[model samples]
Target chain A: MRLYFEKRKTASKKTLVIVPAVSLVISLILTGFLLLAFGVSPLQTFAAMFRGAFGSSRNFAETLVKAVPLMLTGLGVSIAFRLRFWNIGAEGQLVLGGVAATWTALFASPYIPSFLLLPAVLLSGALAGAAWAGVPALLKTRLQVDETLTTLMLNYVAILIAEGLFYGAWRDPGGMGFPGTARFPQAAWLPRLYGRVHYGLIFALILAVVLWFFIYRTKWGFELHMIGKNRTAAHYLGVNIKRTILISILISGAFSGLAGATEVAGLARRLQEGLIQGYGYTAIIVAWMAQLNPFASLLAAVLMAALLVGGDQVQMMMRLPAAVGLVMQGMILFPLLAGSLFSEYRLRVSQPHKEETS
Target chain B: MILLVQSVIAITIRAGTSLVYATIGEIYTERSGILNLGLEGMMLMGAVTAFAVAFHTGSLVLSLLIAMGMGMVLSAVHAFLCITMRANQVVSGLSITLFGTGMASFLGQRLGPAENNFYLVGLTAARFRRIAVPFLSDIPILGALFYQDILTYGMYILIPLAWFYMFKTKHGLNLRSVGESPQTADAMGISVTKIRYLYTILGGMFVSLGGAHLSLSYTPGWTENITGGRGWIVIALVIFSMWNPARAIYGALLFGGINAIQFRLQIAGAAIPAPVLNMFPYLATIAVLVLVTWWESKGKKRLGAPAALAVSYMREDK
Candidate 1:
């Protein structure tokens, strides 16, 4: 018998949920072995991690703090990914959003009304992120610049701009030379729900539901989906690929930008050095792992955040590197991508040819 | 003025050497239609591994080999995912980078000796130092070229060899055919899958060597920020080179020159901020990318981008 792959007529629905879950289990088992290779007890390590991430309400709330950015950026990346536009600049866009929020809080607040400060900060951040992301989108549509390279390059640029600001003009005079801006006034702060977990979690949940409806139930989503799956078919169906990509990418950047804004306004309460965390990078894993589903992204974000929080706990309690969480996040995709093959194709065992059998 | 020029040129060659190595490797990978974005990750792993191995084994050659082996392992994963599984190449590459980055960082923190307290940072091992070529050392201003580490000297030989292998040989022709039109290449009896897998892994070997050069020659040690986004810059360099290994030299020189200036400005202290200076290479890459894209849009002769760069191939589909 010989084996070959036969394309499925349609994707398997069961694997849609089952594969990721199985892949998560597979990833954990594999990471557990990795811990064993390092002479650590995987079971004990995992137990410590779980307790660190969710041992108490306080711990869970901290996990949510990390999850908020992951959720927003995951949703952000999935929108752009839907159009097959690789927006790796979510990091830069997030930084740009924070920069905009900082500008709004520090410079614009004196002129604007106190009540409007928070809205102004979030909107400005989202707009800044959109504008930063808009460059690659425009270039790709106009001149066919590689979006991946541009987006990646822009990440450094955005990080540098933020660094220059905080390390230079924005350095807090009252805070004894720390590399950060002064704290924002009360009007600009994103309200905390509990234990420093801010209102960003609510925004993320609302956006996920809204985006789910938008992507699954809307005509525009259909256009974007068609363009991603088969652009020739989309074009045959009279879809304006360029316009759809531009609009979706802008909206995508807005989410990452809002992630940055909320991070500053709600979490940090000031623009600081830690604002440029790798949440944007983690967002890619979240988007892909969630299979670009908005609602599922919320769950993936929380799970990934748990890894981060848990990884930190192990570092503190068990003396393991915090990057174990990142390693697991990175490792999950290998099996997931490999597993995707089964969803798209069924393995068939064919009988030997008659002549060969004879 | 002459002294300044000499210093800048020396810095350019030293700095450009690693970029050139990575650019050539990435060029080969892209030429075979496999875009590997995990250069930064691979480089980090290479840097950490090389430094760690050298610190422990005290064998420079062994450390370099191990670093490249690690690179080969990561790229092989990419090849399996993208080729056998027919996964999205971009996401596969991104995942590899993520894995490499985390793995490198993890090892960096864990692979040190007791005295260093289990950290690879701040510990120096055997490193390649500058040696002046006997005859060429006397040349004015240009003599700076003769004074470089062994890695840079190796670069002086490999550049032409790589260019020849790519444009002047039958194997490269097969490689080009595979990238340009895989179906046609298959019709011509070339094994597209083998060629892609071979070149991608081979290219990764060279990329990791570039990373090894950092720990063994450039910075002479491992730091968490050792690569400092050089891996990403190599992607930009590959585009700036328009996928030609020969053309890659120009991109590397420009990048090197930008870095040299950034270094000088940082030392000069106060005309411009350090962060602004640091942004130059990225900003320059953006400018170069835009210019190249705009140039290609003018419908020039050819920019050398492989027609099937990121497209996966299958026999039955054809």
Candidate 2:
């Protein structure tokens, strides 16, 4: 018998939901084996993970804290991915945003009023992210350079630039050679929810709703979707493909920048080493897992955040490396991608015909 | 001054070896229409596995072989997802990278310097040593290139053979045709799937060789992020070289020079911050990417990218 994949006439809605759920289950089973190899009982490990992520109010709050930046970046990535614009430089853009916000907090806050400080920092951060993203967008549209490679390259450059500033110009005088900038003034801090969770959570939720509406309801959203589906067709329909792509990427970059700004203002309180993290890369998986839906990305981000938090728990409890979470995260994508295939195509087994009967 | 120049050139050759292998591998893979961003992860895995094996057994050849095997195995996952399942190449490649890196980090934790000095010492001992050519070592300026490890010398031979194979052979013609227009090639009775799977796996093995070279020769010890951003640099180098293996050698040396200059500057206590100096290679990569793309767009000559570089091909799909 020969096996082949046959494309479906129409996608099954049931399969749309079932595929991811099945994939997640399969991934868990696979990771359970990995945990076994690491000399930990999979059940106990998973139980610990659950407890670590949601055991107490404080644990849940910390999860949300991690989720906040993830939500914003995931939403940002979803928007760009929807338009088929591979803006992999969100990490860099986020760093630039943090730098911009830090600049505003350090130099501009002393002169500005308390109310204006927050807005100025946020705006500057978003603008900085947009500007950094604009480089790749311009290159892609004007010169036809591949945005993926440029964006990826820019991520390294951005991190290095941030490092340069932290080690040179922005190094805190009282830090005694520490590789970080001075802490921001009190005026620049984002208001906290319960003395731990920052206001970034509220912004992320609001942005999710706004982004959903923008993508599903607006005329420009239709154009962006059209462009993603077929650029030549969109161009034929006079959708102003270049303008839409440029704007979508800029908006995407802005959200990621806002994530960076919020990270510093709400949590870090300074431009320090290890400021960027791999949240930008994680958001790529989040966006893909959520199928590029803004609202779904909120849930996906939370789930990913739990995985990370739980990963740390596993490190402490099982004496396993924290990279297990990253491994699990990567494992989830593989199954998810593989499972997605079944949504569009079905496997068929065919028997060979008998030559004598013919 | 001449001594400094000589040392810098020697350092450049040392640093460029891994990149040369990675670029050549990627060029071959891209020529067959598969873009594997998992090179970074593959390199990392290769490095860790090589270091671990060499540390335990003190067999350099065994370590290199095992690393190559691991690379091929990891890339097979990529090939299955992108080619067989028709998943997005970029996402598949990235997933491979993340998975590989995470796995390597988890496995190599115990092999780090702080955790085990004995293993590190073993790795250092098993590392490839440089060999000086008798007459070539006496020559000025050009002498440094001849004084390299066995792998570098092997590369010196491999690069020419690769170029000839790609530009002169019938199989190379088939591979290029498969990448440029798979449907046309398929119509001509070529198995697109076979060619892609073969070249991608082969390319992945070469990438692992690059990684093995890193742990077994260049640094001669296990460290977190030992490859640093060299994998990304290799990707940029592939484009700068216009997907030509011979051209890739020059690009690798140029980037290697940039890397060596930063170290020299730091040693000389230049006024610039070390981080700023570290940014030179990445910045140069970006600049080169833009310049090459812009040059290709402006010139009458088209970029040498395969027409179906990242597209998935299914025989039954029109």
Candidate 3:
């Protein structure tokens, strides 16, 4: 018997829900083997990870803190993805956001009113992110540059720009040689609702709702979906592909930029070494795991954040590498991508054909 | 000025060795209709694995083999997902990078001697040393190619052979046909799946070798991120070369020359900051990409890339 595939009449909506869940379980199992090979017990390690992430209010709050950036960046990425634009520079965009936020909080705070300090810092960051993303969009639309390379290359450049400032121009003089900017003013500080968790959670949640409406309930959302599914069709139908790509991508960058703003204004309190903890990269996993749905991505962000927070916990508690959590996070996508086939095609065991005769 | 120019040329060749390998590897993979963005991750894994094994075993050949094996295994996963599973090629490539990067970082942390706190960072290992060709080393500028490690010498032959294999051979035609139109290739009695799978895995071996060169020859040690975006730069070089192995050397020279100049300027204490100077290569790549893309657009069609690239062939689609 030979195996063959037939396209499904309509893509299975259920698979969209089921595949991610199944992929999670498969990842856990796969990671178990890895854990065992390293002389660690999978069950106990997983229990430790769970406890580290959600064992107490404090740990869960920290998870939420990590989840905030992931969610915002995930939302940012989904918008570009909606138009089939591969904007992998969210990491760079987020870093640039943090950089711009630092500038606004430090230099612009003197010029702006006290109450507007936070708004200005956050807005500048979002705009910086939007501007950075606009480069590749213009390149792709105007010069036809393949975005994947440009976006990926810009990430390194963005990280370097941040390094140049904190290590050089913006160095905290009083801090005695630490590579970081000075702490922000009190007005620039993000007010916290609970232990170490700031209003960024609220920003991300509100944006998630607003983005859901913008994506699903508006005429522009229809254009985005049409452009994503069939760009030729969208173009033939006069959807103005170039303009939509530029605007949507800029908005996407703004969301991720705002994520960086919240991160700096809330958690780091200054641009520093640990500010870029790969949440931008994790957001891609979050966006895909959520099937590019804004609502689902917020939830997916939490799950991924738990892995990162829990990974750190294990590093402290079990002396296991913190990268194990990353390993688990990356592992989830393999099975998910492979399993996506079932949602679009049906497998059949075809009878072997008789050898052709002359 | 003569001495400085000669030194710069020497550094260019040294640095270009790794880029040439990676560019050719990516060229081969994309030529067969597959785009693998996992080169950075693979390079990191290769560098780490090569360093760790050589540190322990003191066997260069063995370590290099294992590292290439690691790359093949990862690329095979990408192949299976994109080819058989028919997943989104872009997403599948991205995931491979993610997974490879994580695993490499994990291994770098876990696969070291306990004396160094089980970290590959800061440990010394066996590395390739430069071997100078006697008469050739006396030449003014061309001598740069003679004072090189075994890996760099390999690039000299690999570049021409790769160009010839892809453009002048029937198998190369089959490979291009598979990438340009898998359906037509299938009708022409070529197994598109086999060509794609073979080249992808084969290309991955060279990519790993490029990483191995970094640790074994250039830097000679393992850091958290040893590739430092060289893997990404290789992607741009593929475009700069217009997907031809022979033309890749000049792009490598341009980038590798930047590194030499950057190093020299830093030693001379130039007014520009190190970070700012380092941004040139990336910026230059973006500039080159725009130029090449614009130039390609002015033409009718078939600039160099396979027409059906990144599009999976199911045979039933037509």
Task: For each candidate, report its DockQ versus the true two-chain complex.
Answer: 0.71, 0.64, 0.61
Deviation (Å) of A99 in candidate 2: 1.1
TM-score (all chains, Cα) for each model: 0.96, 0.95, 0.95
List residue ranges in candidate 3 displaced over 4 A: A236-238, A353-358, B114-117
User: Across residues A1-358, which tens digit of lDDT does each residue of candidate 3 receive?
Assistant: 6677888989999999999999999999999999899778999899999999999999999999899999999999999988889888899999999999999998888999999999999999999999989999999988878887788788888999999999999999997877899999999998897888999999998999999998999989999999999989998989989999999999999998998898999987899987787777778778988989989998999999898889899989988888888789878989999999999998877665642220
**Decoy 3 TM-score against native:** 0.95
Q: List the residue pairs that clash in candidate 2.
A: none
All predictions: root-mean-square deviation over Cα?
Answer: 1.9, 2.6, 2.3
**Alpha-carbon shift of residue B18 in model 2 (angstroms):** 1.2
lDDT of 1 by residue, A39-101 (tens): 889999989999999999999999999999999999999999998899999999999999999
| Angstrom error at residue A349, model 2 | 2.9
List where candidate 1 sits over 4 angstroms from the true fold: A354-358
Instruction: Write candidate 2's Cα lDDT for B1-318 as tens digits.
Output: 887888899999899999999999999999999999999899999999998898778899999999999889988888888889988888888888888888787777645455562234333547899999999977887789889999999899989999999989999999999999999999999999999999999999999899989988998887777888787778888877888888989888888887788789889987867676666656776777778777777875756778798899987788
List model 2 lDDT by residue over A211-249, tens digit each: 889889999889988999898999999898888889889
Q: What is the interface RMSD of each candidate, in Å?
A: 1.5, 1.8, 1.6
Cα distance off (Å), candidate 3, residue A298: 1.1
Clashes of each: 0, 0, 0
Residue pairs of candidate 3 with colliding backbone atoms: none
Which has the greatest TM-score?
1
Q: Give per-residue lDDT, candidate 3, residue A3.
A: 71
